[model samples]
Target: MFCFLRKLHKMESTWPHSLQFLLFFSLLFSMAFSKSVIEPCNSSTSCNSLLSYLLPSDMKLAEISTKFNINPIELVGSNNLDQQTSQTLILSAKTTIKIPIQCPCINGIRQSVSTLYTVQPIDTIESICTGFGNLVSPDQIKAANDLDNSSSSLESGQSLKIPLPCTCFNNTDNGVTALYLSYVVREGDSLDSIAGAYGTTVTDLVGVNKLGSPSIDPGDILAIPISACSSANMNLYNDSLLVPNGGYALTAGNCIFCSCGPRNLSLHCVPSALSASCPNLQCKGNNLFIGDVEEELMGTGCNVTTCLYRGYVNHKVLSSLSNTYRAQCTSNHSNPLSPSLPPSSIGIPSVHVLPSLAPAAAAPFAGHGFGSGPTAVQIASSATVSTRTSNSAPFILVFLLALMLVFIPFDPNVYS
Candidate 1:
């Protein structure tokens, strides 16, 4: 090793000073594309976030869970996947899934410190970002970890920071609590189609984005508002217990979980089947669990008593009972596991985008940046960011041409 180092030093010394400077300058030039779309959040408020990740290749359920450092159960629950999702179950490529995020403020910016993507032998930064559906960008990832620009692909087994796009916007859009999904635009995607699939309208998409045109292409990141049923339970934790449409979320310190179906889209708080034990959840008198409901035959209808989840406070599970008369319990009670979803798959398949039926947008500020929830509207109006666009291309291209003219070799990954 010593002999090799000496020889390497000899070779490096033979290189001209201009060559070394050119190489260093080229690396710096590449970082010009390293603009991050991170939301600058310095608040103490909790930011519940989600990333829309498209599978770059086939991988087992456990593999993805490990990749993002999320529990397999939580992963499945977030995407409304079937309970069959296990560690070894393999998912197909091109499948898009939602990864729940508890985004925290790091160094005055809010992002997920987890979700580390290990470098694979065949992996490149471009493939990592673009192939995974632009939940992250090569520039963002590179800047996040101060990665080398010597090559596009790093050594296999190298772990890198994946700065996924997320938002809080006070966790509300307009006036309601919502789950903000940072959706990346793919080929053949249109505002109308995306809106229809997610139950959002074009007006909301445009209003949230402040986009003058609906034209989008692959690699562009957009904030998608999914209708969520947040716990009206006001807690000392200040948690809204927001669950995205057609998905489930474990909350209240993992003691209780809530679901909001694709249809109905109502809050359904239940004792978690996956939890080993939980605090007392039965509502007194009604003798029902956190999510239980009982009905009695009445004259022309049914008398109903429900054990409702109010909120968690001071480490205590809060429950309340409510009585009402209903003509019917509705068809949703047919089965808890199976719910009527749209044409696409919900669990273990491509999850549908749940749209916002609320007011079309935020109090119009402005931004072309990627952010989540009501904060996205604020990010759009405030930040001076443009990452996955032609905005910085000409500068990079001109610099690259200058390097070529001077016969300086640079990594091809610089543009990403």
Candidate 2:
């Protein structure tokens, strides 16, 4: 019995030691297997924030996780990677790895306007109230605005505030001031002419005035606007040029016919406005938009004929820039009087004209001389600017990618 009990005690003690050894060895084996099982990220920068060393060919996910003091699952999630539950985890080796992130908007979202209305001219209580007869009356307008009973004679430049039909007036402050302008009616004014003068469409006038016929008569009090031409031309000149379209009027400036000092002379064919298209072509009755400028900038000092010709030539040059990309080519010589170029010869466009304006080119202003240098430079610079604008998108993307590479982190043990 003593020997058997002694043997039993020995067996029990050996069993405990065996269990301890099995547990310790199992843990060691598990760690070793883990070091060789997991794969590395495709890109070195992927999950680099959690990695302590660069990924090696032999190292695995478990080894990287231990070295970085991070969970293997966390590392995969951070890198936007898929975790493989199977024994074989093969990762793609690529120079770039795509991780979808919400891109920030470079341009703000656009919103639609709830209501849109245009400015009108010298709106009187009666005329404005007529548009919204149901909601307001002329009497009410005169009373609310403390106007005289004879509201028909409103000032030419005054803006009249009114409301649209069917729109609710939530409060007394709902009314807003709208633009009003002056328009002149000639003997042969048509609906189209009147609308063009006012910068409003026929449909808008018809809708507002509810007219039955398209015809307008002379001496009619039509609301129109003083064109930007008058303002722009005036600004360019130290003095103002307020000539009417197709009518001759004395403008306060140097004469187009004589180099004599500033005088009052009439100009024909919308003298206040500059030509928008090539000169020599008939004026299409559109006002020249000479925005607010000073008098000194107004005079090109050239005669009307030369200015018109140069205007047409300018149109031709602008059209070329609009149509073609940067390329080496020769152009035919253009007509001195028009934009039409001469026939091609010897594969090289012949050079013509002394870049300077001729003495009789136009009424030359004092101290005003034309140089071809700035004109040529402007043409080349314009072409370059257009080219850069066209290729800006691709350049932006490449720049962003370069920035990403520069900022991204890299660790040797990341993929190990």
Alpha-carbon RMSD, candidate 2: 36.6
Candidate 1 CA-lDDT value? 0.61
- Looking at candidate 1, the ten consecutive residues that score lowest on lDDT are 358-367
Cα displacement (angstroms), candidate 1, residue 214, comes to 2.4
* lDDT (tens digit, per residue) of candidate 2 on 1-416: 23432443445434453453354345333322210001111221211111111122333446434432344544433232333331144332211111111111111211111111222565545445333221234443444346676434666655443311110011001021111122223345566755553334555334333234544443222222111113222122233233221112222221110011123222222122212222322222322211111111113222111222112122231101011222222222211222222111101111111111111211221211232233212211211100001112344445544543443333335346
Compared with the true structure, what per-residue lDDT tens digits does model 1 show for residues 207-244? 66666566655556677766666666433244566677
Give the poorly placed runs of model 1, Cα more than 4 Å off.
1-38, 106-110, 148-153, 234-240, 251-257, 263-265, 275-281, 295-303, 310-318, 324-380, 383-385, 389-416
TM-score, cand. 2: 0.17
Superposition error at 204 for model 2 (Å): 4.0
Best-fitting candidate, scored by TM-score: 1
Candidates in order: C-alpha RMSD to true structure? 12.3, 36.6
